[model samples]
Target: MPTSPSDTLQRFYTAFSQLDHATMAECYAPEAEFDDEAFSLRGRDQVAGMWRMLCSATRKSGAAHWKLEFRDLHADGLQGRAHWEAHYTFSATGRRVHNIIDAEFTFNEAGLILRHRDRFSFWRWSRQALGLPGLLLGWSPSLKRQVRSTAANNLRKFLALPPA
Candidate 1:
């Protein structure tokens, strides 16, 4: 039987809470797309790689600590939405972060996710992650673009690294 949207998301979140990128990747289709305040990614490889890069970085840092929570999940046919929160240390500045996000998803015919978009406040996030600078310019389009550029660059660098 095909997976229900709620079940697929539940599985995804379960893996996320454990920082299990492989399992998270399993929730997406080969051509899946993902986007958020930081950056956008297309194809399963890029999307999955993002999670792997993040989880691996945090784990290797030895200072990694985080939590994920999801609620208000709703699904209709191939679409789903959920309210989630992420609590973690911002790797760049070693700042504690509590990010609240709303996620929308679209599923492929095989019951795998084809698109995943997370919406959150860059201003709120910047204040926590970038501190003074974010407080002053978090709402600036330039600042937001810079953040997205940096994140994409970082992901590219991570993707370029050879397999362990």
Candidate 2:
């Protein structure tokens, strides 16, 4: 029997907490879609690659430098939702960020995630990650676009690297 939607969500978040990007990626279906404030990605490869990149970045910050917490997970039929938070240092500025996120997911019949959307305040996140610049421009559309562009470029660079 296939795993239930709730079980899949639990496994995904658990893997994230452990910085197990491979397992987190496995939770997504082959054609999964993922979107958030800074990224809009389609297909499991893009989604998985993003997780791999992020987990790698988090790991380099040291195990004690970052933490993840998740709760309020619920699934009904093919849909699921969860609340998660991450406390970590932003590698760019060495600034500490405590990000709160709410996530929604749609699962395939096999319980792999078919779609994942994470919602968070970009202004809030920017304020924590960018320090003075964020405080001055976090709410501006230009700033948002710049962040998105930079994130996309970074992901592209990461994907270009040869497999380890």
Candidate 3:
């Protein structure tokens, strides 16, 4: 009577598609970690908070749709990868942006996700979504360095927090 990693991943994806932060949080281990270009977060509370913020922002921005397509699922199901596309209108400018990202997830024996990592090109993302300003700013070497530093700092803070 043990849960499979694929089952856990499926549940996680279902929760994410529904924007069900609580259920999504439940799919992660208490001490799990998630990382992407923007930031890294540790623990269920921090991950839940990140999901809440993202969902709230998406809603506020009048997102039309968000979907994930699984590209590959390992046979053992210890790991998997997916492609995601999100359509939303910018709250400030009312411009529509389509964000595409590739994500990889890893699970532990308990069927809880231990790590989730996302890979994407910020420069291309900024240019396509935010236009010239984003293109110039995002591609700048200095800005990229700052972004990485900020993400590390955020991760450290999340790891330092007391468990909820």
TM-score of each: 0.95, 0.97, 0.75
lDDT per residue as tens, model 3, 91-155: 43565666677878777777787888888888876665557776789878776677668656654
In model 3, state the lDDT of residue 48. 72
Q: Which parts of model 2 are misplaced by more than 4 Å?
A: none
Error of 2 at 10 (Å): 0.4
| Model 2 TM-score, 2 decimals | 0.97
Weakest lDDT window of 10 consecutive positions for candidate 2: 57-66
Question: What tens-digit string does per-residue lDDT give for candidate 2 at 2-21?
Answer: 89999999999999999999
RMSD to true structure for each model, in Å? 1.3, 1.0, 4.3
Task: Write the residue-wise lDDT of candidate 1 on 1-164 in tens digits.
Answer: 57888889999988988999999999999999999999799999999999998888667653356888888888789999999998888888888889999999999777799999999999999999899999999999999999999999999998999966
lDDT of 2 at 51: 93
Candidate 3 global Cα RMSD: 4.3
Clashing pairs in 2: none
